[model samples]
Target: MHRDTGRDVVVPEGLLRIEDCLDATGGIALPPGVTLISLIERNIANVGDTVAYRYLDFSGPTGGHAVEMTWNALGVRMRAIGAHVQRHAARGDRVAVLAPQGLEYVAGFFAAVKAGMIAVPLFAPELPGHAERLDVALRDARPAAVLTTSAARQAVDDFLAAMSTADRPAVIVIDDIPDTAAHDFDPVNIDVDDVSHLQYTGGATRAPVGVEITHRAVGTNLLQMILSIDLLDRNTHGVSWLPLYHDMGLSMIGFPAVYGGHSTLMSPTAFVRRPSRWIEALSAGSRTGRVVTAAPNFAYEWTAARGVPADGSGIDLRNVVMIIGSEPVSIDAIRSFNAAFAPFNLPRTAFKPSYGLAEATLFVSTIAPDAEAGVVHLDRQGLTDGRATPVPADHPQAVAHVSCGHVARSQWCVIVDENGDELQDGGVGEIWLQGDNIGRGYWGRPEETETTFHGRLGRTSTSGSHAAGAEADRTWLRTGDLGFYLDGELYVTGRIADQVCVDGRCHYPQDIEATVADASPIVRRGYVAAFTVDGDARVVVVAERAAGTARVDRAAAIEAIKAAVMRHHTIAVADVRVVPAGAIPRTTSGKLARRACRADYLRGTFG
Candidate 1:
């Protein structure tokens, strides 16, 4: 089944049966001696003068002034940077990047890759502890040097000043670096299996874990993405507002564009302060050809609520394939976006919900291009009871969730029981995957590497019991995601670590949020967070009450929500906080940062 909106096309059936969708090769192909850096070199050699990256400076509101870089120019700049780095850092040394998204950021990243240095990209500081997080990352990574914009130099300086000389890594201001002069250096000889990058997990202080991505792994994943999604052929232009620190922003969008030799437009803050700018960028790309872009679920929701400006002229979105990922997939957000932009030629299927992680080098299962948006309606009661029982969409017990589609080409995924046994179709379990695309392991943490990567057990078949023999021979990456397969399509339910047990039943935070939103129009649907406080599970609903109405009486609202939840699912709500709109914290891609929010709440940062 598919949906058509004038110029937009969606193929729902294309993603519904992912296992059956591929040929016998299973999408895994052994590339003949290729690495990620090699791919970039090839692109530069072929399209050396072709424009690669274009950026809009956020300082200008109108966004007419921008900077552009061609492949040849980028290669030259990268070589100079690599030469400078080779003088200071050796192979396998860590080089950190702490700049906003732009040409310089990409150049720094690629230069690190060429120098055979592990690239560590950090988020631009937003709060007081931002520097502390960077400090922790610096200490953990033990980088040879740090790269930052001139604007961020002071912060880096202050951070280094507080540290002992022996503890601090050398800091280099990106803008301060002069052009290469007289020094000619060869790029480091990098092994395909060597570590390419270290993507830091959000929890910096909590045993800083960085997913160790390899050049070969990332390169194969990019090839799979290009082949499976047909990104090389279909997408003539790419635009992204996702932050560079994120896997989706870096590998999925950035690497693919470079690998495919396509022109890419980027903005660091455009999607954050004003999401409509992303839509505007897409419309701008439409004038040339179809533009493929990506964001999390909330981005779509935000753009839908705040309508894109018409300007007395129509902006067609039919050619846009807005990949919704980097967080939990929200079906309501997808439906709302489609309805909101129907008149703008936004096809229902254009919202391609995908699933991936940094350990997988970003690209994993993606809804096939032009595939009808895939959905799974399951018994909410059964889902909470640790069983996945399909329910009719209209059934009172039904909960609608979208599928992340199928595994990307060259990768294999399985739903496994707690004992490491592969579950049958429609059975919920932790998502485990194995492929050449899988990252090596966590950087500098052998114990964590063993726990998350090497020690994971593999399944012999889709519906087989856990084989103890194969566990030692094969390496599987535990995704920490709780999901199930229906008709070969993967439907993510919740994070394994995010599940809270309430009244002997496991309640997913997402399920709680959806139910609370349904109970009260005042409750912000996706902003709700359910977690445990002390010994008891608590549901905290943060919402924006209607304007001009009586201020939300917290005591009454809490009781009302408690009663509503009890009546519907026999679950009790511990608290409900109604705040001004936009109080909830979200990731750059627009997914709720639940852990960050919980920390903020504990620190009294949120009212």
Candidate 2:
């Protein structure tokens, strides 16, 4: 069975049967290599002089300098850095990248692969204002060397100084290494199953869970994204302000580089400082053709609400495909972006709602380019009762969820109940995935890996068990997210770990957080975390204050929030805390850390 994804690009045949699709298409594929290093070598030989990357430095001494690199130039630096790495590390060793976002980071990452070492991409310590997460990751990976540029040498030095000599790795300064050194180092023999990189789960604060991504998994995912998104031409360029350590950023850059596509890079801090920079880059790229870019939901809302020009000068977004992924897909965020920027000629189809995680090597399901996002309103009470009952727009309990489009060609998605029985359509349960894109699992944690990566569907007959041949796709990935399907499209509700159960009815924390955020003017949007305390069926919400407001009347705001939840879904709020702006903890990808917030509440940290 096939479904149309708005574009003439039809979802591949037998989309529901992922295992069979893989059996059919695995032998004949192009664009991605058997190994990432081989892909780099292929690009160097084919498009050596084409502009591969462009880094925009808004705060450089030259005042907005553009540092460009050709594929040939990058290859030379890659080999030189690889030669330097070979001096201290052997093949299959781990190498950590801690450089600031720029060309140096790119060179160092490719160099690790060229030297046949597993690359661990992490953020520079000073950029995020702490090294706690880096400390955790350093202890986990225990790399042979650390890669950084002169710009971040001091910060890296300071961080490594705290560690014992035996625990510390040699720090390699990328800029100091002369490109004139030997660029003809022998290529290490690499297999498709070799580990390419270790993508740490969250940045700098939480205990890092290194996801061991293999060369075959990454290469297969790139091909999946390219074919599913219909990236036929090499002329299409990518503009990204996301950090290099993030899976989204790394995979986005990886796809273009492997297929000889050009990309424009900028610091994430630069984008936050001036969101208009992202707009300008997109507008410029659109002139040549459709520009490709991606970010989380918050970025779209932030750029649209704060970045779009009042007079609309230097803004034309006609040919831009900005994919929204990472966190839970929000309908209000999409509407807010379209309403703010649509007046400037941005099409309604520009916002592509997407869903993915680190376990799947980043790119998962995304809306097609030609269609507007599909949205449906559901009754809140019905949702808690395990039913996706549609409600009228004016209904008191109505909630809207945007579809994450169809899964990639060879990927299968199943919504299952607690006992591992597959659910019928409209039954919300855990999301299970089966595809080549799934990673090898967490590094050095086989027990956790087996439990998460190796899951089996209920083999017994049930009301919702897949009819036949579904047993072939038995080995599935437990996504840990809760969602359902309606009319063949996937809709993610929230995380299983974050689902709040009150009065024996299941409720998503995001739903409660959204209600509180919209309940009062004082509560900050996109910064609310909803959780529960021990011995309580009532919900607790921790929210930040909006900027430029006078001291809020906390009591009045609390009453309004409590009243709103009661009116909307007949729920009670056990506690409501409104702290200073930016008080809530967030992952490096800008998602609210609900578990951390709960721990802080228990410890009275916000008090």
Candidate 3:
């Protein structure tokens, strides 16, 4: 039975089942009034000699060797880094970490947290002008110090040399620091409410914002994840290739592994260039225990097409729980992956589609372990007609997307219209969430913080008194996502901001792009993009044809796409610009960054 508690759907029976699991497992109860750093410190005391991190130092592009760091060794390294920072930087200072993924990055992060400093992590220099971008972030954040590796030292030095002396943070090389510095200082007491990190949101200056997440908020979110997903069992180990800078990568995988005393394998670029390595790691790691890892929706499609072998020998996917998130959840991607990996004994139920954001400290809802990955097909016309009508799989123009599942224990989610009124089931609306896991607010910008974090819906309190005004007492986060709840599960449609309105009708760009993708051989499925141009919407497609392929004969491809889109949505495409393969902009986690692409298009760089 489901009970609507205004903010979330309560499953009382599911809560009982989780409690039973917790009782049987005898898991660590999170002691009150403790910081995230304390959890790591306590785990080190108990699991001193156990392996905490496994790293591969790729000397060159050809070959590399592996190294392991025990819990004791990692703790010692963290303390040393922390001590160095404490001596050089002030408490509550922000420290920027710019380096490739490795053991050093992990150590630098924890050390900052231990020193009562906020760690600001950014991607390594990859794209052109990345150095300039890093410099901007460093200057804006005014970090006390910048942590980098020996290899990155020269690059960082060069970047700093270009900036004024007063604008640069103190650059510190991890390899140059002495190990003896670890014992020089005593551990300081940390408050759970202290800011742990300042996570920057993706966007240009007009929309730039950073969410200030506190230790208590992160810890509470992790606890909710543990309770909701049964992650406290010793048999479950965490593995991730998601970049540590992102909130999902940090809080969901990194913090959980550290605090839960479970071993984790982290590599930033490993899964992106070669997804098979992730599966290989998962299979090999699962011999000791079950492996839990996560990636965005595209990774599943990419890996399914290239990673798994046909015969399925030497691959065991049965014990792997692949949590897919960080972007729009595609039912096609999930089903395709399941079918592709089924020969390797991959369980259909192992694909977990979840919903979350940085404001919630990462996870807000997750699919139940026993439940099959959820998918719902809606009638396209009805969806555009201001209502959601579930259609059969065989129906024409049926749009299928995966559900993000039930809400987290410490959080509540709701679907509300633009007026902040609750929408009935199957009505697409903005996703609003409120709970302890909600982050403190965006850092530095009070106006943006108030607008983003403190908005409301008028509702009678449990005490039976009506609260008037938008900011009465309850606060709900405006997720800016369009989705609906079906049978108690939340299925995200697309971003509300991404929707293009024309002639009194709302058109989802993703849907138009998907239709275009189906009609053209050159256009890769899920590679077509649709965005607004001036006042009208335009379609930009990136096809997978050979680099030197002739474009003169592709008129039919364009015509087919135009016809399909017009037939489906009655919206004429303003223009169709087809570029070479790999032209689409994607996030580090493999999510298609449509906004980034639009920015690139405006700059005339997307060809």
Candidate 4:
């Protein structure tokens, strides 16, 4: 952020620092009864002129263009868009934002929520290969208005035309809304509990569902995320290429807003086209302060393998804290990424592995940025038998799982059995979360929403650090993720819903999939899916071959994968299928859609 932001409300030097806003306890505190919009207003009052956001436009005459928006401008534009949205939709109506990732999208997202309407943050119609997700979310949300930019207007219109929705939403070109419209903007008295946005789940499974997030959920979780990562240790700037529609990507907006600092962003497409741009953005944004960025495990691997320059040249990651989350954390990927950048002063502790889901409003726990991410090798049999027994890192059956971190203050997590009875540390079970950050529930599926959002603590829950904090019979958000705690830190294993059983012993497909991935170089990493095949009763492993590999013995590859799995897991594969590259299914966020693959196989779609 610039020292002077170009003012709407200039604040004194005393209020300039976030550290100065600490409460009597000498700890950070969010003001009582404040909404995300009001918090932005507070920051505007404090540092309205400071640059709040900067977008790196990759499509330009010069190959790149930088666009900056100050707090004052951001505030004015959000209000302007809000006013225009209010004219088309009633308060509390759903307004879908399908704008491209940039200042326009951010402003419109904030505006819809500020207008007291539920904002549905989604992507433009043309992002390749996610049409099903777009269709599902649009039909489910049934938005009263579609917020988009002139660049995406025709595409958005065409997308809507194909949908069999009850009504065609009024489409507004958000960038076309002028700042002067703020003069007539009605400031909505938004309650903290109001459903601010419908955050759609990253479809690791079929049938996408929307999680209802509130202003309070967003605000408090940002605090949790920032505090966990020690973001405000210095004047901080956030840099990200994660799509803003995703929960983790929202931090690009929240972190800077919370700290009254600057955030540099680029479209996910920009980062994908050239991952080196990520490092470049990090280096450039260092001018503002320490840079905090987040991404899934694969990104780190991809960037390390395909993005880094051979020369140490110009890149410095010493001031960067990269939060890795939203999926299973790969210890090997993290270590390799760190080692690849060691020549450039990248800190060993730069990659912080965190665990979160949309149901918990996206942040649950994370290894502190100052510490090396925790890794424990658990005995494979012990883990599958419901014990998180630590084993030597070199043990053949040792499963290396990264610890997400300790339970943060004011948040509670209790491992529970299928019956909801609490389990002790080292006992693998469903992760139950209880915190202000937990979202209310799913958008319209009442039955699923109730089961997912409202879970009670078992009678015998009183031993660990999480016990006292988690009251008896208190409700928890069942994470549906299988994990166990060891030495106070949480280690997530896999998703309960994705687990497959063989001979009454439950097995996490990730283990089998990992074994199969290493069977041969022919297998594409992260593209293997393990599941049951009894229309479905027997175990099946389906993996995609590496792209561009022309001549190969398909039978030989399948046999190699099956032998590797049996050697490692002692489970004979009922069937092994080696399909062409990109033949396997994956969620929109790029996770292997295992169940979807299983369905495709049963339907003979793979043949």
Candidate 5:
């Protein structure tokens, strides 16, 4: 073992080997013989041991310190947890990990996979604003066991207390499990097609749905992400603070491990409180020469505004490639981040605008590491008319959208009309994906799965080298996202459900929300939700008044929002309400909860 403390166990003979499934270079191909945990052992033993995973502990007495876990140690923990969990949960049963962000979360996830169980990556009950989501996910998955830490046991118990006895799962205190239990770890025969985890979607439009992600899908998507970002370098290091349960965060947890790279992590709370901690981690991780990480649009804006060191002191981002994606890629946020970090040697080409969703196992496409973010200025009315027409940046109706990059590696992307007929280059329509990384479908919803995951092209769709020679029977993922292809890049507009239509013209809510925020400082930036109420014939805008705003100004703020939307979008608002900060809801991924607000609005819950 690379960092041996003299504690070692014999290699289990039952362990499946995946070496045969891969090419000689060990770069591509994934067969069902072995799981990710199996490869972790072989990779560490074949190469020398190194720091496989690291956690930046901000809640510690020493202010902040990094806890390192070597690859060998991580393997031991996996086996220890795996063996203990198997004793509680039968093979193929759902096992939810309810631990906080740390190595405990990481080990618990891999352990479930090694035990031939379907892992439902979830959050601790203490994570505020997500309690309802946790309950819904557990009730939906109906996991046989829940793995949590000793510190979180009481809260976990309280959370489960609300459920009936039969619905409550067996709780495993992962930290209390003895390391010696790893000796009893028995690797099960798992197929590539077997369900590996349930990636619960963020309910921006509807209730949270668990996507049945298979082992094959995870492996294929991981490979696609690594190759797309040129992250195959053995020295790659990943730094992130995203919640591990989310799709992108779950993928980042192992992005470094698939190769010989190391992962540095911290709590999302820490990153939010002091964004500089993320920048510091990036600088520290840059010692490896090739560092990769990811974050949503909000994180970039926050890090730029409050994270960057004033003098550009110690951070060096010369070798960092941070993938930025969140529904609609914010072109302004990208520019702000690069400009703020430029003094620290952050290259203009370092940030990659990308597109992905849980349905596709979290990755669809991302710009190349070598290319700058692809953005285009288009006419606002043209985009609303289902056509992407370019206009001058100074044009009054000009709107900007960043490219989520071309379809990655082997995936196929096609923009099709409502009838499933392929659209031309400039046609803005629903974006569909055909790839190995796509999840099986929504868990336990066969009809919904058939509608979402089973789509056939009405006609042949061809887009530059991608989606060529499409078979008539290839199943496509109807990624409810709306976008179009321009010069080989995918420009995601907005969700199909999130679109507001009045007088036969479709408009994305984000554009109206942006104008609302700009209309007056009274409106909180990035806290506006625009939707249509009263049967899609009337436009409604609900905005969050900035913190410390006077109650007397609500009328003027509402008037400003209405006037701005009418001027910019040429739509009359049927109702405008300026609510207090945080009265508006937001998804866990930091997206405005427009649908939730609409529900409350319909219930007359907002005063």
Candidate 6:
């Protein structure tokens, strides 16, 4: 029988079969007292020459080559960087890493952690126009040092040139460090309770806040992922294009290292430039062993749109398991990817949709590795009433949602109504989470921390004890998202702040945005945002036009968008603004920043 997340849960038959396989395969187990530092040390001793990281460097003199690093070699560089960092900053100090995406970035991150400092991975300010974001993070994190490569050192200098000299952090180029420095390095012992890193949340709503992840929290979440992804009893390899700065990307790199698995890393630019590389990399990895990778929903849709030939191009994907997360899991995206890649041998069971945030140290829960994603077509009206009423696939008002599986075994989640009373399965409400994976709180923001981290359930439990109150002091995280459960699997509906209420009827922005995208040809796909003003009781849509569509009639496109939303969601649109491409804001991970768009709309920034 499958184990429950926290309370008694009936094991779904599909999961039970997975458990049986686990028993047959001798399920994977997490190594005790594991930290990134410890994992590196162990791997250095046991598998020194085993490839720990393989960065696909496109700009090298050779023009696109794998920059390989073995456990031992990586260990030496990390120690040297650690020595340099410790010489300048004390333990617990924040060191901002603004390196190009390569070995230097990985080494710098580990080095900071190895020196007992809180590592902050951030994009180099010069590339991708992240100067504003970098400035904001540096100001908030107040890092004592900044790490960069020789190539990006000039950009880092330019970025620091704007800040006050007194407040500026000392910049260290990772490539300039001497190998001899490692011999002089004295390693710091890490406590499980010590803060490991400050992973800033993707700023979809406002400025990003650093989430304080502890060593204990990181180890716990890594185990949660290893168990959830079925990494044990299998030779797991990874291919990832996620940015190293984000938690998801770091998880892909970090989790594999901790599990003694190897991953092939490519810059996010590579995947966006040619989505087929991700498919090809997965195919290459699968030739030797089972391959695991993760990406946001958009990447799947983008890859499917590439129309890779059914001739396969020597791509065999039967042994690949793609873990989709970092945004709301889209049933449409998963289905499209499956259908597009099926002719090339992609198994229907390959897509595993999961849910998580930075506050939880990365993963929360995911579908069982071997099973195909479970989808339920629910009536939109049922969603409004906070009940997930499943309808036929062909139902007129049906909206399909993919299951994010049960909560991580190490974690517990409770859905609570507006008043904070716990809601049973099928009852839609805010998702509150409790677990060891939960972070300490938002760094340097105690008020926001208390409000976000310390949520409590209202009313008494079935046993007549207060679920949470004075004795507990908001023990659960107030995840600002809305979702419900069916058959013990969680279905995230939408973000609470982005929910659109027009004419007393509630609508999810994603549904409306998807509707608008499909309604018009000129309006670009994946660049739409839908939201309502505070006092306005109507829907407003802002969509970016497809490139080379400057000649297209904006007024007609707006009309089409409004008509589409009215026909599909049956809601009248207050206004529609069609702007040029790249006008709408998106998070670093490529999720549409709806709140930011709304603010821009009010400020007439769109005009």
lDDT by candidate, in order shown: 0.69, 0.79, 0.70, 0.82, 0.84, 0.81
Runs in model 4 lying further than 4 Å from the true structure? 1-29, 164-166
Name the TM-score of candidate 6: 0.91
**TM-score of every candidate:** 0.88, 0.92, 0.89, 0.94, 0.94, 0.91
Collision pairs in model 1: 11-370, 11-371, 11-372, 12-371, 12-372, 27-410, 28-410, 48-72
- After superposition on all CA atoms, how large is the RMSD of candidate 2? 6.6
Q: Which tens-of-lDDT digit does each residue in 174-262 have in candidate 3?
A: 76878888876456667878898877665421243567888877777877776666665656777776777777777533543334444
Tell me the tens digit of each residue's lDDT in model 6 across 1-607.
Answer: 3332222222222211124322233432233444667666656655678888898876545556788888878878988898899888998999999987888999999999988899998988766645667788899999999999988888889889898989999999999999778876765767777888999878886788999998778877876787777776436877898999988899888765665667899998878877887888899888899888988888998899984755728888888989888446888788889988988889888988899989888887888877888889999888988899999999978888889986776477878888988887788888888877889999999999999998876753453221332235548888888998888788888888778887777788888888898887888887899998857575788988887777877778888888878888888888888887789987888888887789889999888
lDDT of 2: 0.79
Clash list (residue pairs), candidate 5: none
Give the lDDT of residue 358 in candidate 5. Answer: 95
Off by over 4 Å in 2: 1-33, 203-206, 310-312, 460-474, 535-538
At residue 446, give the lDDT of candidate 6.
99
Q: Estimate, for each residue in 147-242, the C-alpha lDDT of model 2 and write its tens digit.
A: 999988998999899889988899999999997764445557777788999988864124668999988778778777766566656667889999
Between which residue pairs do clashes occur in model 3? Answer: none
Clashes of each: 8, 1, 0, 5, 0, 0
lDDT of 5 at 599: 86
Evaluated at residue 529, the lDDT of candidate 5 is: 89
lDDT for model 3 comes to 0.70
Point to the candidate with the largest lDDT.
5
Better of 1 and 2 by lDDT: 2
lDDT against true structure, model 5: 0.84
- Residue 364 deviation, candidate 1, in Å? 1.7
